[model samples]
Target: MAVKTNCNINGIDYYRLRVTIGKDRKGKDVIKNFYGTSKTDAENQKDGWMKNKLLGINHISIRDSLSMAMFNWVWDVLKVSGIKVTSFERYEGIYRNYVEESSLGFMILEDIQRVNVQRCYNKLHEQGKSYSQIKNLHKVINMFFKYAVIEGYLLRNPCTGIKLDVYKKEEDVGEIDLFIEDEGTVETFTDEEIPVLLEGIKNKKLKIMVKFALGTGLRQGEILALKKTDIKNMVVQVTKTLSFAKLYDDADNYSYETIVTRPKTKKSIRKVPIPTELKKDLAELNKIRIEEKLKLGELYQDNDLLFPSETGTYIDSRNLLRSWKRAFEGIDVPYKKFHALRHTFATQLIKNGAQLITVSRLLGHASIKTTEIYAHVTESTKADDVQSLNSLFK
Candidate 1:
């Protein structure tokens, strides 16, 4: 090792230290440079590097920063991990939106401490980011740091002891509100509202779509990904879901696409029994589709979807949501989200004596705990059950 004083590079003066850390596979010397404002600073960096090498944390190059390593990890590890494109985009978004330009991203990978990770999360929480958003950010960074530790780029994970629950406000503490979508509150439609809503929708296809959602409890994405072959013997097989997302390319240019992938979890892959009444409506819709396809001939871009756009390609989810909202015009009932159709299905099932476990499977929930939210028995049901006991007193 040699320390050179008063070195000038890029018009900046610094003390530079050069050292031969190791050899390559061909037995050639591997040289490294450490620069700092003073001789003590430069020597301290060199000593730290030597100590890390001795402690078996040696894979990371001194020049690697948090953003540099994170991007490489995302491409090399996550892209090929068989995750959905939407999921991959979500991870990438977290990095770009929260970490890319922050001070945390520019820090040397090996030099980051737990305090640094905590500070980043603290800043995001203080900025009024939702608990879910910050939690996701923590999850990404924590996983990345774990990868660094396993790859020998880091001696220890800085995100080990970080706690996000402590930052959650009282309003955030509650059961997952199935009634909420996109930060909007949507209540389940009552029995009376259901008929009013159906009568109000002028679009023939949108009416059928709403009926399907209520009948089967499928999510919006799952409902949209349905095909003619997915339904048989009055049962709908849910193996996949469709999502619309704005994705960024290598040049950071964004474009929208409809992505189809397997259900988010294994539980989401299920077969739901279609109601007998819904069978006729589905058949009618199929007839309409066949008629349209034949009329269009080669103009149709058929992907064999149960619901397709005007050109027969995957329907944009945003457009579907917009159309759903518009269907309530001049209707007597209050507007509820498309997701409320699913909630109505579960709530009615529980009210009508469906077992909690059965409801869980029908909703494709990963845990029965999530299904507990729908276990609320209506006052009418409770009163009716109590009225039956009056016969014994008589």
Candidate 2:
């Protein structure tokens, strides 16, 4: 016989399963026990004893407990906290791959010691993960142990003093200044290659979008958000952005959808000058829209998107990504992405000696510090400084 009960003991929650024998109305003895929660451990222990009588487990021994149940409870807590769906999914994967394989997964909560955590870190480090990755793993383990403490399964978290300082030094903290790709990093196109790329782009829209990204450093979303109304006389008001992401469940083999959202940050909301050269392209784009509207016997609405698909619908950014891949690959540039154009814009601005603050605003960076990464990526901006250093030798 077994029964279940829940109780809070000294500010910690616990479940008690117990068994006991009692006399029936017929004067026959029966046994039952259960697990339950109450205000105190004694009350919970009593409830568990009652539960044992009901379940008929006469020799029930609550010798050793499992920590797996407690770890699962912590997972539920994290899910309810609104962690990003993708991030939560990855966390679940980590639990299955790493935590479940570790011996600590089955240990009694009180038995989890610093050595247990250190062993887990050592195993992960041997698996070729970076120190940062190991550090994140530590955080997950620490959180589980803390939950154990709160659940009254353990007096204290045994992972408090686990040290991995020696492993931290093995991480390559050096500044890596290469454009990463699926395969590996490659040498990016130089400024001299820009003329060749411009010549290679045959599609007018592709050419315009590329130039816009390179000149204005607008994200694909910000560019997609542009409306005919957004383009006032000389200013391009960047109040909104168009983001393309895949929906969770779309059955029609559809892989992407466009959601009109605000820019990535409030600072990203600012006006940027429309380059004079872009005026001609904008005028042509507008003319095409007007002609399409006349063909359909409807006036072009004020809500007309600045960059629309061939059918006069809003363009899907996934299509734009595919187009970018095709366009850059066609030009024999080896590797160039939509973001690289933004990078090019920033690097070129810096090379031209634009102040960091001005460039930061142009790119809508939340902080000038983020814009500084571009300064590190491009060394051409320091050419003059190199010459200055060499001048002392002369």
Candidate 3:
């Protein structure tokens, strides 16, 4: 009978299958070991290899290494129990976009060399993927390999010790007259630029939404899911998040659905206090909504959402992007994302001397280290510093 043993290497667990294949020509019993991410895969590989050995057609069990492709990774994710629905969906999107479609993703787990992985990373960088996004890709890749190593799918993780650049663009953005380093870092609009941005946005609901994001730094889904009941005494309780998900019909037609889920993390459920101005804004907005409801009467769809689409449906991110772009039109400043508002808020607080721990707590981050990225100043601040040289020149 074939038996399995549990072992861990480099902190990753694996199952080893062992079997005796009779005596060799040297009069010694030949034992073979096959490894797998799962006992079933290991056992099957051992049996298959043993059968092929008798026919003098067996290789080094090279075929035992599974190909970590999009479809296969997805099945692995589904089989792994207790993953949050939102996390699973995010992982699915990452795989389909970066791995399953990339050249590196098509190779067998054993065959993916460091050079191949490096090439893929370079390609993503060349495609203008943000440093944070590339980091996210790397994180997903690391996760896949960690599971692969634990299950013994591969003898080792290919992502290990790959020499790569992080935030290499810093050199190009490093030139500055101020004490700050010269080079592009995290993007954000200056305090002055924010007013211009808010003023240019034509959509009233979106303007308030942007204000709420700047004030609280809440994620798009969290902002979209906000309700009247979630707020009290200027404190907003983040309870749920809503994201767009697609549904298929019997005939294979696709329609979009809103997948409402819990907050992203345990820390994400923290309460955020709003400024007094924002509280007044909310009150005024609520009165407007009440009037709207009374006017629309039977035509109104009342979900009690703080911000919803005109017809009271979930706001689509793509449509939100269009609104974001329109808000920047006729503005002389360089374009930044709607997300930059959150960044702007963080940087402004940092400039005014907010502690990193305080920022981390307000941002609902799991760790203080995650909030460290917001400590850097923007180029606009440096430009303002240069303007002060006029006084020194005199």
Candidate 4:
């Protein structure tokens, strides 16, 4: 229960003080003072305080409260709770962007109201943010408010009732290309440009990497992280990824690190068969590494890294990107991304009349639907097969 009290101010009666019974940090009842002008104002404020207390809102002011910095607090909570690294990364990105651009940065957590949030959203939209981005922003905002409500920051979440026209402004951008019928997105590499592109890369290491990617349908990270132990018979086991490390302040050069992480999905951690033609190439690569190891002697610690640097150190992703760009100078290809090699592998598999299931396995796709993108590319191949079978029947 809360009580309102009045005192004389400049010879006039005014509700200058309000006292509310609330739990302190120890959950014991404590009296809190709220400043107000009128008796009704003081009583209303007291009622709201009691309601908030029942809801378990934090008694501390937003500026002083631990929940004030939504980004930091949420990340700490999620990290301690053992959330997945990839998901936490995305959440962190969203929160970072919001704090940097939204009015939420200027406001204390206690001052966050529905109108304030609405204004923030409008300003963001005016700044030319896409509808999808705005929706994501709203999602993070809602998540912050939801956590606040659950943690007893407020009696009710002010963000609950507001709705936005997120999807209604529909404009049809014509039918998408049906080349890759099952894949929601299209990725096509004009085969005519393959030879011209292959002739450009003079570096044997970079060439081996590019050719291996084209043959195996492995991601850049997965391919670069390949170790000598990963190869057995004609099978390659994907168990780790070489990712570009985040740029560190005061560092003159970027670095790469390998993490023994599973692929994006269960299917992504699959064994892919090496083509018979590349067996000799693989053997040569081993021989070169062995000779290099002997020459380096004690200097070489045997990191077992398949794609080591010129000095037998770990190969950085930035180096790979630079090498790939130099290779692109010789070939005029429509595709500019490094991952296009994986796409090329998928396209070739479909064109060679391999089943979707086999293609899915080779590509380490989690779903058959993911591999079905080749179904569109295989239309001509499938039709040619059908025609040949009909000729046999005749």
User: Each model's number of backbone clashes?
Assistant: 0, 48, 8, 2
Over 4 Å off, model 1: 1-63, 169-187, 246-251, 376-394
Model 3 segments more than 4 A misplaced = 1-70, 79-82, 101-103, 111-135, 163-185, 246-255, 330-335, 378-387
The lDDT per prediction is 0.76, 0.61, 0.67, 0.62
Estimate the lDDT of model 3: 0.67
Off by over 4 Å in 2: 1-188, 246-256, 294-303, 329-332, 380-394
With a 3 Å backbone cut-off (N, CA, C), the pairs that clash in candidate 4 are 56-152, 57-152
In candidate 4, stretches whose alpha carbon ends up further than 4 angstroms from where it belongs are 1-68, 83-89, 104-146, 154-188, 247-260, 354-358, 366-394
| Candidate topping TM-score | 1
lDDT of candidate 4 over 1-394, digit per residue (tens): 5444455422333454335455654566654444344566655655665675588552434432122356445544654566544444556566657663344553445656787777777777787765556666677668766776787866667677666674324431212212111123345556677767776778777777777788788888788778889989988999766655432221122233344445566667788898888887787777777887889888886778777765576677777788888777636665467877787788888777787789878877666765665675566556876888876767
Task: Select the stronger candidate by lDDT from 1 and 3.
Answer: 1
Question: What is candidate 1's lDDT per residue for 336-372, written digit by digit as tens?
Answer: 8888998889889988888989988988887776676
Candidate 3 is scored at a TM of 0.68
lDDT for each residue of candidate 3 in 122-168, tens digit (9 for 90 to 100): 78888887555566667678777776677666677777886545635
TM-score, structure 4 vs. true? 0.62
TM-score of 2: 0.58
How far off is residue 278 in model 3, in Å?
2.1
Best by lDDT: 1
Error of 3 at 288 (Å): 1.9
